[model samples]
Target: MKKEKQYINIFIIFLFILVSLLMIIPLVRNGRINAYSDWTFHSARVQQIYLNLQRGNLLTFIATDVSQHTGVGTFLFYPYLFLYPWAIFKLVVSPVTAFYLWYASITLLTLIISYYSMMRFSKENYVQSLIFAFVYMLVPYRLYLGQVVLGEFIAATFLPLVFLGLYEILWGDLKKWYLLSIGMSLLVYSHILSVYLSCQVIALIFAGYLILSKISIKRIKVLLYSAILTIFLSLPVVVLFITDFIGKGIATTFTGIAIEPEFNSVIVDSFRNWNGFNIGLILMVTFIIGGVIVRKNKQLKYIYVLGVLLTIAATSVVPWYMFSNTILGKVQLTNRYFSFGDLFLAVIASYGLSRLFDKKLDIVRKSILMFLISIGSVFIFYASSTWVLQETHTYNKELYLLLQPKKKNGVPKIPDRVQLDNNNYNYQFEYRSLTGSSDYYPIKAYDNQSKVDSILNQETYINGKRRKLIGRYNTNTIKYRISLKSKSRVDLPVIKYNHTEVYVNNNLIKNSRISDRGTIDLTLDKGMNNINIKYQPNFSFYTCVIISAIIWLLLFIYIVKVW
Candidate 1:
């Protein structure tokens, strides 16, 4: 019997792995199975960290962007999510290898999360878990952001773990809720927005529990321990927040205005239409209604009702426009911003399925529902998989087009002054000057243009106010004069000091340096000063060996203590 049980366990694991592979195949075929977009930046930052590791460095990567005041971008960094798997991968491989390793692992974890949550929250067998996991993997939001590598994916892994931990605290033998606390803390550090939404969900759960049951010392102890432990575990994210707390305040004001996206009706229809009319969700809905009719588990009525409400809210199909506008729109659109509704959907589906598949189903009824479910599955798989493939191919074509080298047809001239706008969307820009040479000069432009592009691929709630890109493109031409109105301080754009000349009040400064950002310490009288910044990449290597070493040392100590 023991041997048989072991074999069954192995078989179940294999089945789960197979289900995960089914979900991954489409993403892999699209050439964008890995995280793309803002993920590229995070990946690059991970690469930078690896570079530091190669040189024995440990400090987290820092970024600069449109909001220069008070280091606005630094607050968003979360090191723990990136480091957990990174440290393990670092043992035997290069940094890039480790980064991909983590990416792949997280993808696998998403499936595992579904399986584990189903097991803990429902009485489903392995097969049901596999089916549920498959459906969850195809969730539109997950697929949409699959290419955008960000902390959200990693952070999402903890959802099931948190649910399971909570289950243990409520009904299992786990006396200490420390493990759940750790998972909750990890969520906080993974992505604050995800954590914030998740916490609200859990808060609702606690509120429901409070209404239903008399408070016990054990329950209060569990709650207090979980909260305290979570806070302690989330210290890394807290510290980073404190570092830029002031900047976040400013960012909040800037992003406060809510803008609604207006797409054409055709686009809207195309988005709503799923490939084979995924009836799995529809069947699940039917089952939910059926459960209501049968009145199964009255204790869970709150979950069923709340889940249904959240599903409507998530899809923006709810009749209450005021509630949707004030709450959902303020958070960003319903579907895009919160996929946690998928959790509630899963709960309703699980409950409904348990009822539908119970002993009472006659042959004809079971067969018919199964057939419809299969058809829906096939339709959804084909539609979503095809879209993923097309998106990948189109992105590849665009990247290839952008990368093709072109022969210079004219001489390139340096711009006298650059004026950048602080609400532009597109990042594609052009620099033209009739006097400018056609010769290509690579200078990394630091403006709002790059910042917006950086965050486009991911959903991020920046903690500070920021400027917008002035235009889609920056054009410089030979016939036009570059002009600027000076503020209290004139910050000279640092360049390679090649052929560019600077004149303050008609007096030419005769000094040059390798610095790309030069500061003008001299007080400006009140009006206009001619500023020219000409740059050519001299490929200066930024050495951070000392900083890296100190960071690595601290990280090492932290790891040793934690482990």
Candidate 2:
């Protein structure tokens, strides 16, 4: 009987997954990806990871061949260890297929993860648990994440686990602290800005909980332990960010924090912008009705109220223009609050429905109907908005075309480098290309057009007074055959930071090799010489990976033992 119940649960969960996946079928069949936002950037990242993995470069911190082979340190700050499996999947599949497969995998994992999270919270209320997972995954904004596929989307995938862990720490079982750690660790691995955004929401929840109940020392300990464990697990990426941001003169990479404040919406969306920038009608009605119908659980009440605060934040209730340059503006985008806000509302809505409908049949029936409604609404909104955007916004149409590049030799090809280098600069290229992103590069290097132009037009890579060399090179290493008039010290236009290495005829050139411009500086001997340049994020990153692996191993063992 127990086994039968478990089997039924699995079947239903899969049924929901299949239904959700149906939405993307047309997209996959037509090869028309939702070229909405940030997909190009993620596409480049997956490609780079795949290339590096093929070369046996498992830890690909820098994309050597992207952006016309100038290289970019995208992986140093972006949380991408989760992308490794998809990167590996590229072994047998085409780039486009792998991209879709990876997205499908995200959808699969998110459904299961969310199911487990709510299962624990609802105490085996299978109908409520499945609905919670279903609603959370299909939240309108999350559907946007599904299309454009931002790093924040990846981070958002694990939010239920984070909520579950928080629930355990505050009101539920404290023994499940590991769930919070794992969730946060994955978030850190997914997107750092998301971590920043999520931390703010967490602070709100913590404060709200404090007002309702006294903080027990035991729960406090669990919270602290979970935090510490997250820090340790995220040491590799966190340490990389810290060292680069603090030690190096890398200026802030983001410029569009509060750029789209007007796009923020609540309850009724005036525009069908499906990019996680709105509060859907279903959620608003669900929360309002749920708040009135379910009055039993105080925690639910707090969550109900918390959802209001999040809505305010999501809708920009606070005047954004005044805080444009202030710390509040650093949210990367104001609409991002909806990423987690909808979670609370979904929980309340599902739990309320479960409680209100006395029979299991009614709960299942309502949940399915609501799910279908959401899907239909999202499709109409997305299709209508896209048509409106094409008619009203010419820039988006151009961007839509630019982002969905044509394939060359079974893979997408970046446009000609010379043409792009000479003609114009597009911000969208920052996500798609390897070079000139100015993200982690030293600030002053690309501070102005002249400087950027100089970097791009530096014809001779060797920058010595009298020495000149030229040859071909591949990812990670550059091989150059040079005939020098005299032995002269030279700088290569290549940018170097964080465990970059230079070798001349198999000799390591350490200390005093990097120039002020973050270029590779080396002395060339008078003769035909071969030079090799390599980058392997050394000791510190290696140690963090090892230590974090061990800690996670122990954590899983503990979870298994306790279970």
Candidate 3:
């Protein structure tokens, strides 16, 4: 009987994973969707890395490059940086076939974590578990922003494990503390944003556990031991965190904190323009119902209830949104972090409905009908918001046309270089000969070396006639300059505190005052003139050491307790 039940559990997980894959199958066969800017950047980065690998260019693969949209240099080699790695199989396998494989892998991992969570929380059946997994996987924003927009599909896989670890540490078997620690550590490696949000959620759960778990020395030991073990296991991620934090110049990065956007616009950007993808109504309802149903199961109730309350508070009430934005100023406020609440809300609603039906209520048929309707509402919302990537036509049709020339030979005769001047500075070249192809020539021009802001005062001219430059590039190097214009300026350009010199004609332009803009007026020679600007972030010795020590101490305590 026991073995039979185990087999049934396995079958249930397999079925849930299968259902999840079916929902996202459309992504498998399509050309890229025109959605989030981040998606395009990540995809391009992944392709660049793969190309470098093919060409044996390890140094180039690791170098940071300025992101046209962000105006900041990005760490390209960050693990989970992009999704195109999975897409490469499109060369050999049909996209539809490839998507199924990718979807199955992502869902199966989610299912394992969800199953473990449910088992630890309640004696639920296969149908109940399946319902929870389905709802969790189908949240519209996650479907839209995470899976389709950011190609942060890997985040969905990591989060479930984080919760599973939390469950083990808080309510499950004591010996599993080490396992829980490892789960938390793994989450850190997946995506830093998700990890940060999870930490907030976990803190609430920990507080609840401390208050309600019949506090005893033994229980304290379990909690602390689990923490210690978790930290010890997180050593790898800790090293990564330190390396990335220092390497990226966190002090300079923090300057954006002062200019973060307000909450109103964040809501508009994230949900108001949902076009059916933002299912805020369905999320609210599901969470409320789930909260009521799970009240008896204190452990289960705490997470869902706290998650809902905190999500609402963060996005609306408490300054979590404002605070996080202010703290992370310069970063746009898109409430993807609240996505974690969506999964738990759906799980609670599904599990509650499943439990309500199990009671064999006198009005069984009516109750089941109501439950089905409620879940169906979510499905409807999901369908309405779900975006279908337009795959009927590819964007790089022009590139393919250009490459047609190469079909007759070994390589395409791509333009190796081009020249431009301020009078006729704009240049456009198609690497491929596709007409109206958008993908072959994706570029963004940066006026300065930083590449952090959009170009507001630049004019383009192609072949001695004015034309809009298709994209932007740096004006720093002679190779990059391609052309030169009038160098004389009436007012100096502002230099950010983090950057040092603004150079013209290989000469350093100094700031006249501490707050003086770093603009310079000069004239360029008719031919090629090299212009370069270099920025080096100044780090605070005291701040860095203090933060470093605090993080280590925390990790040490967590590991020792878990061990």
Summarize candidate 3's per-residue lDDT along 328-389 as a digit string, tens digits. 33333335555666666766766666665554433435334434543563454345444344
Candidate closest to the true structure, highest lDDT: 2
Better of 1 and 2 by lDDT: 2
Candidate 2 versus truth, CA RMSD in Å, comes to: 5.7
Tell me the spans in candidate 2 whose CA falls farther than 4 Å from its real position.
Answer: 34-36, 242-245, 263-267, 270-276, 287-290, 355-436, 456-475, 487-489
Query: CA lDDT of 237 in candidate 2?
Result: 84
CA RMSD of each candidate after superposition: 12.7, 5.7, 11.6
List model 2 lDDT by residue over 1-563, tens digit each.
Answer: 58656665667665656654664454344443434345655666676777777777666766565543444577776677778766777788655455556776787788788878888988877767766776677676776676555677788789999888988998898778788888888999998778777788888888877877897988988899999999998888877876655767665555445444353344456233343556565566765576784577876787777776676666656677676677677875677777777888888877865665445455446456545644553465445335423332332333243333433222233332211110122323333333225566666665664444433333234543423334354556555666777887776656677667777877887774655555666778988767776666667777888998898889888888997
lDDT per residue as tens, model 1, 1-563: 45643553455455545444554455444333222334433443343344345555454323211111111122234444455465457556644345445655665677667666666555535335645655665555454544453656566667666766675676554553554775676677676656766776777777777787776679668877787767655654564445433342213211121322222321243255332112234334532473564366664566556555554444434433465345433443344323555554555554555454644555445444444543454457557557545544434332321211222331121123221111110011121221111111112222242432222211111112222221110111001122334443333222222323344545655663322121112324445444332211122211223443354466457647864
Score every model by TM-score: 0.58, 0.83, 0.59
Greater-lDDT candidate between 2 and 3: 2
In model 3, the runs with Cα more than 4 Å from the true position are: 27-32, 52-77, 81-104, 147-153, 218-237, 247-282, 319-334, 359-382, 385-563
* TM-score of model 2 (CA atoms): 0.83
- Which 10-residue window in model 3 sums to the lowest lDDT? 433-442
Estimate the lDDT of model 2.
0.65
Taking the candidates one at a time, how many backbone clashes does each contain? Answer: 29, 3, 30
How does residue 80 of candidate 1 score in lDDT? Answer: 45
